[model samples]
Target: MRVTVLLAAAAVVVTAPRWLPARVVALRRKVFEKVNGDNVITFPNAAVGPDRFQEVYSHPAANGRSRGAGLSDLFWYWLSPGPEVHQEHLEAGPRYDDVARTTRALLSGPADALSAAAARCAARVLDETVTGRVTLVRLRDLMMPVWAEYFYELVFGEPCPREARDLIVGHADDVVSALKCTGLRHPARRARLTRYLARRVAAGDVRHPLPATLTPTEQVHYLQGTFYNTGVVQMSDAMAHLLLALAQHPDVAARLADDPADDRYFTRVLDETMRLYPLFGIAHRITTAEIELDERTTLPEGSVLCFSYPDYHASGHARPDVFDPERWEHTPVRESHHIPFGVAANRPCPAWRLSPLALRAATGEVLRRFTLHSTVAHTRSLPNRGACLLVRVGEPLPPRRLARIGALLRVRDRWEHVWRSVVQLVLGTVMVLHARRLRLAGRYFDPRPTAGCRVDQPPSSQENTA
Candidate 1:
């Protein structure tokens, strides 16, 4: 009996890497369902098919964000310090218009200029950091400082000071970490960046004029939350995904390297990358009015609609699971079930054009400097942060050495997933419950609006509509 028990234990240990992570994910999903309750309605469900996704998404009634939804509280909590003023979170109104105009103005530089700036920033980071012929890096960590500098230059029209860069990186990292549920929220780290932005605003250092509707403090939060927090973090994650995709597919990487001027091919690669690993998982909206899906089926007002990006991208493609940029060669991205930046009628990503241009430039710079390789798992969540090896140009690792590194990375990443899933479960649950208890979004939308109230103040119930 003792010998049998030891054998069973050994078998379980050997298989844990394959089975444990999936089990944890299942548990995590269950926990999420339990915490958020059944009020939320997911897209691609029976009533809302892939064909109707855009229509439903673009519906005039489907524009509510923070009001009457438990999930909004969770988003508000993670994005706090000024989630209210954050352009993405604000209800559709004058305030959102002002914020949107300011964002557009800030990002209005020529595409080539933005691209050049991104490449310059990336090259500078690599020159300072890559001290060895071969270096192992978490791609997200490597890209964060690059974007920090890029955005800082965009905001101030000057080189990013090391102090400011550090603060930006720190705050963005904390926000994404907490968002991924790999780490808890550190308000102090975020607060430091807020204070720095406040000082900058007070000094009249911002190059673009901020929204007139916001108070001075709200203006500081707006910069911190919108430009530094969301902009830096999303771009970093995007570049990490792009680099990791190149690392995993050596043939594609080689092709890209050989044809440096192949902008068309690179665009296909970028589109495919975004399809496979969309920056957003679930984008939720609360319906302000009844959505008439058909004469028989109607989604009532205040319904929470959760649009699944990964699921939608997975549909309407042959061998959707495969990563083949060639597919895009035959099919235009516009005709496909691809809304990477969301629909045009709704809140599309503000950086839609600028991001692709910047990513192309940054990626070109990295490819010029290093040959990227990785064997780690590449999921949309990217909890592992893209473990990759960067071999300096003209110095390649022997095949055997590369295989050994790949094997070790595979093992390390598998075990890490086992641990990370549990951490996500625990932290995700705590944060969801805490957000509910705080009722940040709920309270913000609960108060009735009065005349002369500040735009950033908790909006009135009537103002919550689309």
Candidate 2:
């Protein structure tokens, strides 16, 4: 009967998404509200992506060498068409400007911005088709220069910190220069590299804001573009945490064999886990345009700083020393309380509803099919504001192994029919044992966000990687 029930449960997990309900989107947003970002109600940002990238390729002067117009091209994870975006900008010429301007009007900022973005986008596209590798150094070179020359100087419009400027520019350059070409063999690593660089560029300092004349909608869209990599990286980190968590839980076999989302098991895990670790948490921006934070920090045009997320989430610590989630049970649910995603209004997390729901389905699959027992207690840390996790798994072992174990196999023929019941008993006991372990050991802990990043780290750093 237990085996029959397990089989049935597995079937349910596979079919649940079609039945997950549309209202789940609202639920997702609500959770994002509680643990993802700042609760400020604002319009959506980041509306201009595809067109923004297309502009540079449009002009004869806009050759694919350096990104001439748009800064948004770094967002694309895929390959581009040229050696450099600048080459395309030159090739594109006036036609480039016309199309770029048109795109910018819709996307945010100015047409020139879109054109620049498009040129970079084209360069990437062309480079991929030609060299089949991305120019990581170029990405950093472009972004850092923009921030240093334009973003810092213009937005700051005051005495900027020479140290901060040096740190940001130098580190960006280091990251880019450190990049080496990886060929077809290391496709996965290449993709990871792409994401890492893109995140840095997207989340890195901006050289300037949209001209004061732009509408609110345009401003929001531009901010959205700025956070592209931030969102992507966060999602990636969260997923890594979930995978590690599954490795620690032994009964993952049953969950994998039969998905848990069907039975609300995955849902429960997702709710707790997402709260604990958010991937895209925290944000920082220049207050040049003039906004409010509080009494301690006032209006300084280009002061580089960030909103705290790790500290906010961990605020309910058991003690100054011990980190415990149980303590947070008493803590009221609040918007800025966590923020593994950004806290700002316009830059609200786009994948808020998307991530948890996906987590449920994906995690449910993982738990049902594998026997992931934690041999070690994995401790998450963000020394560099990114997830560098280490853990071990016992592998395809567990209740399923019972049927494969010779000793556990029932006797054959007539005897087999009689002993089959005994085999069943053995299997059930093993499943229960695995289940118990998963519950007792916090091996299945989710990735929670934390505050604090070194001068070399991004502000929203966390083991809370998506």
Candidate 3:
């Protein structure tokens, strides 16, 4: 009896990798829903489906960003030190306009110059880090330094000092780590970058003039939050996804490497990579007025609409789960259900034009230097941060050795997720509650502007109620 009990316990332990993570993820979702409340409605639900996803997202009434949702507080907390000044969170007003204009000015430049900058930054990072024939790395971490330097150049119009690069990378990594729920946020780490930006602004080291409407402090916050925080983090994640896809699909990688100037094929691969592993999971918006789905169905004002990018991208395609760049050869991007960047009718990604050019150039540099390979799950959240092996161009690994490395990575990632999911549940719940207590978004919007429409209140029957 004792031997049988011991054997059973051992069996459970051995098989835990295959089962534990999924259960934890389900439990984590439940905890998240409970903490965030039930005031939210999801797209692709019973009433709304894929066909109306773009319609709901592009609706004029669905414009409120920071008000009416409990989730906003969590975002604000994660992006603190100046969440109020962050362009994306601000309400539609003069302040948002000014922020938008400044962002445009910062991003505006020759496409070739942007591409060259990305390649230069990527080459520097590769030279410093890739010292071995077979280098194991977290793709996101490997990409972060390159973007840290790239964005630093964009902001200050000079090569990034090592000190500034380190600070920016640390801050962006912390923000994304907390966002993925793989790690808790370190406020001190983020504050270090904030202080550096503050000092730079004070010294008048910024190459471009910031929005004049904002205070000096807000100006510092704008630089840190917009360019340093979001810019570095998102670009790193995007490169990671793109590189990992190339690593897994060696056929595509070999083709691109052989013909490095194949911009058309590279563009297709980028689009398909984004579709399979979209950067954003769910983007939430608050309705400022009643949205009539049809004559019979109407969404009440102040309703929270959670748009699921994954679901929408998954729909309206044959085998949408597969990564097939060839599909784009026939169908135009405008005609497809793909929206890697958000809808054009709404506040689309500010970096939409420059992002592809930069990514293509950076990826070109990476491919030129190394042949990438990976055998791990590629999810949108990228909780594992894309475990990959980079082989120097002329030094290819034997198949047996490559298989061994892949096996080790697979086992390691599975075990890591078991613990990671638990951390996410615990820390994610705590942060949500803490954000609620702080009431960051709640207080920010409490003054209730009387201009166009109120997002805090529900539409009354006398008004335009459903």
lDDT of 2 by residue, 367-392 (tens): 33233332222223211121111111
Error of 2 at 298 (Å): 1.9
Candidates in order: C-alpha RMSD to true structure: 3.5, 23.7, 5.7
Estimate TM-scores for all models.
0.96, 0.34, 0.95
- Give the best candidate by lDDT: 1
What local lDDT score does residue 213 receive in model 1, on the 0 to 100 scale?
Answer: 89
Q: How high is the CA lDDT of each candidate model?
A: 0.89, 0.32, 0.87
Error of 2 at 175 (Å): 9.8
Tens digits of per-residue lDDT, candidate 3, 1-466, equal 9999999999998999889888888988988888887488888777888888899999999999888888887788788766777888878889899999999888879999999999999999999998898899999999999999999999899999999999999999988988877777787887788788989999999888899878887798788889888899999999999999999999999999999899999989999999989999999899999999988889899998899999988888899999899989898998888999999988999999999999999999999989998988889889899999999999899999999999999899888887888888888878777767766667566665434435543222112100
Task: In model 2, state the lDDT of residue 399.
Answer: 51
Q: Pick the candidate with the highest TM-score.
A: 1
Candidate 1 deviant stretches above 4 angstroms: 448-466
For model 2, the stretches where C-alpha displacement exceeds 4 angstroms are 1-233, 249-259, 262-268, 280-282, 290-297, 317-332, 375-466
Residue pairs with backbone atoms closer than 3 Å in model 1 (clashes)? none
